[model samples]
Target: MRKLRVAMIIPDNRDERRQYDRPEPEFGPAPAALLQGLQELPEIELHVLATTRRPMAAPAQLGERVHYHLLPAGRFAGLSGLYLPAVRALRQRIQALQPDVVHGQGTERYCALGAVFSRRPNLVTVHGNMRAIARLHRALPFTYLWVGARLESLAVRRAGGVVCLTRHTLREVQGLARRTWLLPNAVDPEFFRVKREPSQKPWLVCPANIVALKNHLRLIEALAPVAEKYGLTLVFAGGGDARDPYYQQFKARVAQHPWCRHEGFWHRRQLLEGLARATLVVLPSLEDNCPMALLEAMAAGVPVAAARVGGIPDVIEAEVTGVLFDPRDPADIRRHLQEMLERPDWREQMAAAARQRAAQYHTPQAVAAGHVAIYRELLQIPS
Candidate 1:
């Protein structure tokens, strides 16, 4: 049997993805790893297409079946130009390669345009907020969301299938199309093994970028009273342009408050160490789509205190696997944090459940198999 050509579409730069993309390679490897795993199947040929300003060197082949193509993303058309000449170039490449299926990663214009221009039986994956994320930027939030929605709809119309982080996320693009599938983000239990020992001063950890809608400021502010009264300490793990106005205010607040410390960004291994020692993990974001950090925390046997938004409600039960709070209300987050501290047995049990769930669902082999099944169904092949 011949292998079918499956291509994954990504933004101009792997390191410069937008809000849904997070401009960071480490946070979302949906492209880097997912495609690799699919290629491992002997009867499949996988390709990755990403936008780039200048030409980039191709990676050495992972397996005989996998290939990568880094096309140059050209200059914007004119004033306030976002469409690039490379988009057309990509269309040409897609025509020539003629992939059996194309998968999109982020909401970046290049990826959407490339896939639209490709005009193939494609898969568009929503990492988070395809339409709603624009609300975060006040200045041009309307334009951002409007254009993104229009583009996303066009891409979905062109694709044969859609993959989302959770079922609730479909509410954001309900009428956009049919054939949407649910697939949550998962963690490797081996890498993030749980270590539940008798806990001490309940330490709180959050591994997310300090940005607006991530709602970290309110989380910090909530910590003030908690620190003064309950005696709490927080460790933040991630970095961005801290000098940005929102982040600057957050930084100044952090400086004034002695209880919280921003420890920059840690690699996956180092982050595992932090989570293992943590009493609980807090994911207080205004919006999200099953992020990797939450899964890692759960796999590491650290209970979660997250906001009730996005695909979060899909994964976390109010007091089952973990606790849920109002994303907008840091006071709510503080309450959950304090509750976890007071009831060690309850929180630790939640952590154990989280670990068990992660190990069962989110392994590389298991996730790979699930994805390959999607591809096979597209190709009308048996597993």
Candidate 2:
């Protein structure tokens, strides 16, 4: 059997290149894991093209089967000029590689939007609904959302298939793509694990980028009142650089609160450590699609208190596996937190249930197999 050439394009390589220096491992094992999983097909040749502004500390010779291409890009804030360059370079790279499929991850500024221009069987893995959130950029205005929705719709329409990280996002992209794949995100079982016993403290955590869509401000607002009533310590981790204006706004608000400890950012090990110490995780985002943060937190035996938006409800059940709260209403978050905190054993049961759910749904092996199956189906390769 001939090997299938695969080109995996990632746009958010700035953090992967360690440019921020803030230390959340910016881009973690996601790209690597994707390549690793695809390579497991044996008849697949995986080549990763990570395009970003910051240079990567990559090896001169990564491996025979694996190769990395770094395209120079301007700072993320000033990406307008680099878009044409990236699209041209990426198209040229795809031509040279002649991959059987062009797989793009997320709504990566360059990868998903730019790479979809290739007429090949492009597979876009959109983790969340950016169009819905683009409406909330504040700085970008409604015109931006209108333009973004058009482009994103076009991107979805052009792609041969789309792999939505959750069903919630799939529903949003309805009538756009010719084919949609319900491809959920995976977690490193080695890192995020099930707890043998419950921990002390009603510590709730939400680890996500300080983007507007994340609704960190709402989470902070909820915590202020929750802390007073529930005696909970809300720890905010995994921050963004100055580009994320929400971070500054959130910081200003958090400064007023004495109990909230914004840890800025932490990597995988440190994140797991925080999860280990916490009683529950809260991701009251306005949007989501199986956010890896929520999955990782759940896998670590920490229950989540997240919004019922996007694909989150796909992962968390209301009061069963984890709690759900309205993202916009801080008082609602506080109320949910109060109720969850009140039931100590209920929280424990939910965490245990979450761990079990992770075992069934978000494992690396299962995720890899699912992708392989989907690819085989897309190519119509006989079993």
Candidate 3:
């Protein structure tokens, strides 16, 4: 049988290239995990197409059957939501490659524009709901979120199909897209392999970027009493822009409380290490759609306490695999955190259940198989 050729348009941070001065390209964790799972399958040939502002050398081949292509895109290609140059370049390259399907990773940037305009049998994954986010922030005209929201709608409407990470996303995009599929994001298998090493000091780790929507300030305020009472250390393990007002406030709050530690950005290894030492993983985001942080925590055998908003309820079953709380209510957040900290046996049971859930549903191989099934169905190939 002939291998199914898939062209995946994704974003590459160019972090490894610039940091280590190496030529290898790096993708966000979710895409990287999907690629890892897909590569192990013999029935597919994968071509990764990533855009960068500056030129970077990348190997032509990633593994036995996967090809890599790094293309140059304007630094502000989709800032205004046009993405004309990027779309043209991507379409030309994709036409030349002539893959069976073009898969765009996200709609917030140029990837969705590139894939939809490629004029191929294409599908796009809605990693974030830009329209909802823009509305939440009341994003003003000409801002990134405002522009991205418009482009997101356009891309979803034009694409042959849409991959919704959760039912929340499905409800958001079903009206816009031609068709939609509910498929969760994949977790790196390495997360599952890491052995848990709980910290002696009660540690609650929140591994999301310090942004307004992440609701870090509220989280800090809500968990303050719990932290003080239990002598618990709360760690924030993601990056934030210093110029942002919310970030400034978050830093001030973190400083006021000695128990709070903002560790800032961490690589995958460091994050996994932190997770290993974490007594519990907490996500206090105001809105999210199957966040990779929660998925990673589940895979790492840590019980999660997250805001009961968006698709979070889908990822965590209250009191079963993990705990859920009202993000808007500080009291609810405190109650759940306190309960999880107080009941060690319950936490352990939830952690075990969460790990089993992650293994069964969100594993790389399982997600890869799901993607292949979607592709075959789109192509009308017999199972």
Candidate 4:
């Protein structure tokens, strides 16, 4: 039997200019996890296509079986919905490779647009809800979000199949495509293998980037009273440009609270180390679609207190795997945090349950198997 070749498009923030110049190309967690999973499959060969802000060196092969190509953004990259240049660049690559199946990693970016442009048997994995994001960002400075939303709709309508990361997104993208599969995002097993040693003092960690949609400011305010009462140190991991207006405001607010600290960004190892010492993981996002941080926390055996929104409820069984709070109310955030702190036995139980959940569903091996099944079905191969 011949091995199947698959082309996957993933989103990344690697410095393309320096990628070939350096020994390695920096990849974020999502692509890293998926690549790890897909590479482990013995009968499959994989090609990855990603986009960069500007033109750089040409295509580069990462491993024996995995190939990566970088597409440079043209002058209209930011203004004309992200990934416009990717469509032309990726289509050329797809034509040359002519793989059995082409998969787009996310709907909100050039990956989907490029896959559609490839004009192959393309499958798109909807990462974030662009329509919802556009609605939230309509009044914000970024008007491209609205354009991205429109492009997202176009991509879905044109895709041969759609892979939805959560049931929430499945419902949102229903009727747009005939074949839609629900698959949760996978977490790296390294997070599960991390040895957690609880902090002596109460240490709370939020591992998301400092963005307006993350609702970091409100989370800080909610923690103020709790921090004063319990002397808790709240650490906000992940970083954003200091020039971003929302981040500037977030930094100003973090300054007001003596207990709050913005830890900027931590690479994977540092992030895992922080997660190991954390007493609890917190997420108060206004919008999300199965955050990787939540899964990583669960894999690390830490209790989570997060807002009950988006795909969060799918992974977290309220009071079972983690505590869910209302994102809108600071009181609710405080209430959930207090509950997680007050009940030591409950926290331990939730941690165990969360770890078990990560092992069963979110592991790379399991997720890869799911993708293989989907790809096989799409190709009409006998099971």
Error of 2 at 130 (Å): 1.9
The lDDT of each candidate is 0.70, 0.71, 0.89, 0.84
In model 3, the runs with Cα more than 4 Å from the true position are 15-22, 76-81
Worst 10 residues of 1 by lDDT: 18-27
- The count of backbone overlaps in candidate 4 is 0
List model 2 lDDT by residue over 112-199, tens digit each. 7555876566788876566766655543544655555555676787777889877777887888888998867777765454443445
Q: What is the lDDT of residue 89 in candidate 1?
A: 65
lDDT of 1 by residue, 1-383 (tens): 66677776765333253332332222254455455456567877877676555444556354567766766554452113555565676777788888887767755465755665677776777775656676555326337566666566676666666777787667765777557777766455454544655347767888898888788888887777768676667888878684678778878888988888889878766686787678778888887878777777777778888888888877787798999998777678778888888888998789888778877776666676777778777667876
TM-score of 3: 0.97
**RMSD in angstroms, all models?**
3.7, 3.3, 1.7, 2.2
lDDT of 4 by residue, 1-383 (tens): 55789999876555422344544566667767878888888888999877666555544776768888776756555435465666777888899999989998887667788787797888898888898788766735546677778888999999889998889888888888768998888898899998999898899999888989999999987878778788799999978878999999999998888899998888888898998899999999988888999999999999998889888899799999999999989999998899888888999899999999999999888998899889888888765
Candidate whose lDDT is highest: 3
lDDT score at residue 263, model 1, on the 0-100 scale: 90
Between 2 and 3, whose lDDT is larger?
3
Error of 1 at 355 (Å): 1.4
In candidate 2, which residue ranges exceed 4 Å CA deviation? 15-29, 53-57, 60-64, 73-78, 136-147, 194-199, 241-246
Deviation in Å, model 3, residue 207 alpha carbon: 0.4
Q: What lDDT would candidate 2 get against the real structure?
A: 0.71
